[model samples]
Target: MTAEEETRTAAPAERLWDLAGRWHGVAVAAGILVLTRVVQILLLVGLDRAIPDPAGLRSNLLIWDGGWFQRVAAGYPQGYTYAQNGALEGNELAFFPLYPMLIRALSAIGFDPGSAALAVSWLASLGAAVALHLLGTSLFKSRRAGWALVGICCGAPMSVVLSMAYSESLFLALVAGMLVAAHRRVWWAAGLLGLGCALTRPTGAAAAVALAVAALVAIREHRDEKKWPPLVAAAVALAGVPAYLGWVGWRVGEVDAWFKIQTAGWGTSFDFGDSTIGFLSDTLTLADGWVPMSVALILLVALAAAGVALAGRPWLPLAVYGIVAMILVYGQAGYYHSKPRLLLPVLLTLLPAAAAAARARPRVAILAISAWAAFGLWYGAYLVAVWPYTI
Candidate 1:
């Protein structure tokens, strides 16, 4: 082709390239998250065929807590037995509202509960990745660091939950969105996202602590403004746990109905890590011959410790969120074996390691991320496929 023709042809491609370059941060993060979800979907598809469940493909992505969410989305149908005398002593109260509500909305439009929940989860995971890209890039001032953070988030062992009909994806999206907004000093937006986060998970109260910390930091740095918005954000976030607990209490006709549900129904409460320590002890002693379980638990604890040690290096809000989230997750007397999955919402816990990986030489970073991705790619499948543990 002539020079003129070549230039003309390249113009269209140039514009496309420019647009893509402008969106590189969000695109990269979303791409990685999507890629992970695709892998998970593929695994689930295979699992569906291998197992002869009537729901088939729909059931693969809606296991465990996903099942509970589906039940809630259906408005506690007549057969749902998690309720006791109008009080929830079962898994129903243990689950939050926002996720089920979203699924419910989609299901109303003719989609099945499981499929709707899975689709929403997939989209939310991508949204979470995009917001995380913004926060990571802004906090660390390095694109590599931002992408690394996304990688860590997507590659964590429990990241498999992101693809399932679970609240982690939606919760993370709102959380990361609020954090990004706070970093940008968009107080109103932060406050709004904080509200959604509040409704998404019980641990969402961490958003309040984090937002309050951010507000205080802003005050210290003389950058405070729109004071009401930050305060509102903090208030809403702080209210989430109590509000849910209060509702549970009212419904169950006991002030501590929620706590009772967690304890009697789910075997979860505040024992200050005693149960965790005991579980670790049992696993390490080979009483169950599940040495790998012990190893996984140890690594998770190490990750939390390492994350805290590294938290001091990140933005103050992130540090507060990570620290408080970890405390809330582990301080409670929840299922010890579910620690890794339960802690999935604490995305900041991966920031320090992610930053380290980003700063390393290119090949080293690739190796680090590749290893993480490898483990996460299969771990969820194994949990669902081979093991009969709580997913």
Candidate 2:
């Protein structure tokens, strides 16, 4: 290893202190997320006082997916239903378990299911921010870039979901933590975190792929990284996705029941963007679909920018992971309206842009964040109080 690489990898007491002090940026990021969510509540509740769906701002976080997760946590006694009213019913088993399990555990302690779910997301989002900061600092070799990455990530227009009862924050925390552990060559932590990720979301497979690739490359480059944990992580990653699917299938009494749950229950399946293109085409002729279309289009532009930024970049693992995740997301055709929310997991795509902003002046970063916050408040309110799409 080069002297500089050795210096970075072998951190002494001063580096540890610096690392601890640098958490100030994480504090700012967390505060920003809290303030953003607060603004969202203010706008949503103030604008639509007569709308009583969610009942109140505190309860609002459990509106859409939160309702599903809470129902799942409630045991989903109804179980899988292929159809209701002669159409796809969206079974509760279609929802993943870790988030709901967390909510259930919290509810066991006297918290309302909705509030518990929201608390999981809120706390997980902050944890994810800290992990993202560490991963960014390691990858970019600049504390400014790390802080900027945190700001940019939480500033994503849909970041309001970070504070809701969604699993995105929890999944992100695991993913970011896995990335940091791998970067630090903490093989055991990486393996265990990868297992945590495997249990969290399907995208965990993408992370496993990226990490394995990095590990293999490190071996080829004679970096002296361990060999076994990567294999174990990959095994967990490969097995974990199937384990949940298989269990759901077995519980439902059909070997292909998991895929059926996605199709017959929720109408979700791979369509290679045909459904997406069709949705976009229909958007021009339909009035009611405009909001979802606008959201998807804006996200498309951002994704395109991210693709451009990541092309030819040096961060192979992150790029591969982000690209693979995006491919899987875009390949799926069902539920076109939720595309933006679906893309939230592949956030490494934003690193190139965030790093550039970090290289700019502090005011530039402030302006970028300010603009996103202004628009995010409106977008977040729309999601909470108005939009019908399940985020």
Candidate 3:
């Protein structure tokens, strides 16, 4: 082949590459989100049909913790809730304020609490998709990777929470947006987004620390530049989680009130993975329910995935955020079934798969992700529709 022949052959490929470069990544992320949601909803509807006494798909979306969030949207209690036996019980205080606050604001415009909550969650989920795309593109310098990240995250096992009346969507949007801003050295936006994240969920603390790490990295790399902004951004982000925790303590007139409420209400406390290990051991060895065993396997796979992501040497702040988030999820003693949902927003465990998919041929990657979504969407739908316990 001569040079002219090679140039002619390469021109079309070059044009295609240029077209892809001009395509809007956010739109791709949105498309992936829509596709995943459609698949998940279809799965939910099919599963709900097979189950006895189906409450319909909408009701299933609002079941379990949806009531708690709705009550919170109505109003928080003045103090802790207690049983007739005088034992403290879990109450609205255990939940963070940011998510319900948005719900309340939307409800004030005439929408019911449930609709408002769902609206906030769905809108936040869109923001999360866009932000996650930005984060992936920024980290890997590949739009394909960004789209892959969005697709994988939306289709992750138990990711149906992203569509439900839950704070996970809001928290994910804020955290990913913060990371994107930090990576771009937009300290103010990063700081504000980080603060939002910290207020949205307990794992926001991990995000806050991650933002601080980003700031520190920036400061170190540009020693002579204006340092105050990054310093201030780190300080603001670092303060957010503690500030909310302090407010909760003051509201309840006990420094440990939030921790107490969490433990009393949901048996949620940091036991350094003891409970998780025990559950995994029992479920795997004792041959418990399929759901329990599946959850155990998911946990193990997530841990392994995280290790693989770390071995790839991700951006330092992201690595820190992922590590801390995993620690919080695994170290806590809560509903074993809920671990997968909690792991959804961690983002770290999904990175390796996303990157691999991004590197594969387009057809191969699509086929692989479709196979994954088939199982993940069905798994999530089954938990909500067929399983008797909370996700």
Measured by TM-score, the strongest candidate is 3
Q: Give the Cα-based TM-score of candidate 1 against the true structure.
A: 0.86
* lDDT of model 1, residue 148: 82
Error of 3 at 266 (Å): 0.1
Candidate 3 residue spans exceeding 4 A from truth:
1-23
Compared with the true structure, the alpha-carbon lDDT of candidate 3 equals: 0.87
Residue 244, model 1: lDDT of 77
Q: Model-by-model lDDT, in order?
A: 0.73, 0.73, 0.87
Flag regions of model 1 displaced more than 4 Å: 1-21, 44-57, 76-88, 223-226, 291-312
Model 1 lDDT per residue over 60-100, tens place = 56777888898888764322235546754565776778899
Q: All predictions: root-mean-square deviation over Cα?
A: 7.9, 3.5, 7.1
> After aligning candidate 1 to the native by TM-score, how far in Å is the CA of 312 from where it should be?
4.4
> Can you give the TM-score per candidate against the true fold?
0.86, 0.89, 0.93
- Give the candidate order by descending TM-score: 3, 2, 1
Question: Could you tell me the lDDT of residue 29 within candidate 1?
Answer: 79
Candidate 3 per-residue lDDT, tens place, 1-391, comes to 6798568545643543343344475678898998888888888899999977887988988888888899999888887899999999999998888999999999999999999988999999999998888777777778788788888889888889987888999999999889888877778888999889888899989998998898889889978557887878888888877887798899989999999999999999999999999999899899888899899999999999999999999999999999999999999999999999999989899899889988999999988988888889889998998998987
Candidate 2: list runs displaced more than 4 Å.
1-21, 50-54, 76-79, 82-88, 284-289, 312-314
- TM-score winner between candidates 1 and 2: 2
Please give the ranking of all candidate structures by lDDT, highest first, separated by commas. 3, 1, 2
Clash counts for all predictions: 1, 1, 0
